[model samples]
Structure formats: structure tokens, C-alpha cells
Target: MVDTSDLLPKTPRYLKVPLIILNTILWLLGIVLVACGGYALSKLSHLDDIINVSLPAGIIVIGVFFLVLTVVGCVVAYKEKLVGLVFYTVFMLILLVCLIGVGGGAFSYRNDAAKPIGTAWDKATNDERNIAQEFFDCCCWTDANSTCGSNCQVVNETGSVVPNLNKTTCNITVVDYVQKNLYVAGAAGVTVGVIEFISMLFALFLIVRICKNPRPKSYD
Candidate 1:
């Protein structure tokens, strides 16, 4: 029989250790991303009407994708499976593309968030306004003196109207809050994308090394 053993790639000792360590770190990062997504969703759930529900949902999806990718990466790195490494690399590339797209969308949305926020404020019923006011700790959607019905009350503990409290309207405050959050999300996407790019490069380097010298060695 032809010796197939010689065709197998021998994994270097140095490469094995770093691969395991890096993959483990990646796995933990994936868990952290998932938790971040869950937290974001929980926070956004309170403002269901005013915020875009899809954004939090998308974060959750991305987190889950990273989790899956991490698991696959660990398995491939442990087994030193060349095909699995290639698949992992390709998946990472796809994920990097997705992250870039998400980042761009978030950054672009920051500029466009004001209009939607205004519309939501305009369409807000009394209950919705109260919810927003109570959550944001603000008085009215616009100026404090502007008509906001019963929800625009800026009262102190003694039921006395708190002067100048209404000056800080939810329109400005909420819009600023949303824009800040979008910027944060965009930054996070870019950061994760860079990490994914690095991971792909590592995988490709291993793939090339394995192709050069096909030998098999057990890491366990």
C-alpha cells in the first residue's frame, strides 16, 4: 500500500500551543459578544416603539454566529484538520464582510436617527410620552413650555413644578443618546472585524504551512 502517512502534515509544536491559546481566547470573546448582545437587547426592549428593534436582534445574531465560528475553530485547530481550517478561514472572511457592513450601517444611521426620533416623538401617545419621560428623566419632547399634555409635568417631590427642568427636552437628549449608541456600535463592529481579519490571517498561514509539508502529529 502507498504510504499515506507521509502525505499528512505535521503540526509544529510552537504553532500548536499558540493556536490552542488563541482559539481559546476567541471562544471566550465570542461568549462576551453574546452577553453584550443580550444586554443590549434587554435595554432596547424598553424603548420598543422609539428604537429600531432590528438592530439589537442583529447583534444577537452576530454574536451567535461568532460563537459557532469559535467552536468550529477550536475543533479544527485541535485536530489540525486542513479542510476545516480552510472552511473556518472562509467563514471568518464572510463574517468580516458582515461586520464591515453593519459598522457602515450604524455609522450612517447616526446621521439619520434624528428624523425617526422626531417622528416617533410626534406620534407618541400620552402613555408613550410618559414612558419616555419617565425613562429619560426628562419633561417634554421639545421645550419644557411646549404642550406635551399630562406627560410633560416636571414636578419635584413636593409636587411643585421644577423650574428649568423642562429645558432639557427628550428630543435633544434622546437623539444625542441614540447617536452616541450608534457610534459605539459602529466602533464595536470595526473592532470585531479587525479581530476576525487577524484570525483569518492566522488560519491562512497555518493552511499554507500545512500544504508545504504534509505530516501528521498528535497534539494531545
Candidate 2:
């Protein structure tokens, strides 16, 4: 009888070719995600309006930092080098931070930002409120409204009369500035969320592919 052992096929000495291909794709995706985040961060400074909060600063710093690391990681991956572990670890952590900031900023802005503006609107006379409401309706939550939600209503006192547009109390520029900043914040929050999701997916793919590949039999 023929020797059965000699008839069996040898197992691959390294990762399967398909898994290596998938890992390479994942590494490329990670590079794209990180690069997009960097572009968003760099463009932030040029935007017409931005909230001067730690959030934007953090985004800019972290985003750029990850971008550099990801680019290096891509070069390493192309060599079929085992750098996915490092890339996935760093990216996963970065995604967590981004998710937190995005969720917090969006929730807080919707609640907290409206409070002062709404209160001011409510304290103003109907005419003033109407004007302020118009501003809010047109500006404060324009992005949200586009998605079918009601815009922020300026808070106005029920019986107060509209204040005169005297030079002392009226500053339309200030209101306009606030509106622009709010819009910027909302857009940034949404963008951060999207980037975070993409980052997360790439991280997962890299980690999964890394895990699937065992050490070569030669190493054993």
C-alpha cells in the first residue's frame, strides 16, 4: 500500500496568500482614514469660523499625529512586516478619543449652546424674539433642521417688549459671529464622528487580519 503520509499536502509555511492580500488592503484603508483626518485638521485653521475650544485643538494635534504614524505603518505593511499590531493599537485608542469628543460635543452643543441663546431669545420682546428666532431658525441649528429637526428657538420673555435698536444695545455682528461659530462646531462634530467610524473599521480590519496569521512553521 502507498504511504498515506507522503500523499498529504504540506501546510503553508507562512500566512495564506489571500489573508496577506486582505491585510494589505486593510493597511491601505487605515492610511486613507488617517490621511483624511489630517486633511480635516489642517483645513480647520482656514475655516471662516471655529470655536476656540480644546476640542478643535485636540483634533488637530491628534489627527496629524495619527496621520504620520499611519503613513509609516503603510510602508511597513507593504513589506509584509508585522507592524499591524502597533498600528491597530494606536488607531483604536485614537478612535476612542474621537468618539468621546464627537458625542460629547454634539450633545453638549445641542443642549448647552441653545440654553444661553434660547434664554436670551425668551427674554426679548416678541418682535425681538421673532428677529432672534429668525436668526436661530436660519442659522443656529440649520444643519439639524436640514435633517428634519426643529431649530433652536431663542428664549424670550412672554411679556417683554421689543428693545430699541439703539447703538448701545444692538450688535448684529456679534450675533452673526455666534451663528457662524455654532454652525462650524456642529459641522466639526459631525465630521469627527464620521472619521472616527472609518478609523474604527480600519483598525478592526488590521487587527483581525493580524490575528488570523499565525507564525510560520519555520519559526516553530
RMSD of each: 6.3, 11.5
The runs of at least 3 residues in candidate 1 whose Cα sits more than 4 Å from the true structure, single-residue gaps closed, are 1-17, 144-149, 153-167, 217-220
Q: Relative to the true structure, how large is the alpha-carbon lDDT of every model? A: 0.74, 0.44
TM-scores, each model vs. reference: 0.79, 0.41
Clashes per prediction?
5, 8
Please write out the lDDT profile of model 2 over residues 54-123, one tens digit for every residue: 4445554555554555555444444434565455546646655765665466456644554454444334
- Tens digits of lDDT, candidate 1, 110-173: 9989898878777767677777777777767665344353656557788886433434777788
Candidate 2 lDDT at 69 equals 50
**Candidate maximizing lDDT:** 1
Candidate number with greatest TM-score: 1
- Quote the lDDT for 10 in model 1: 58
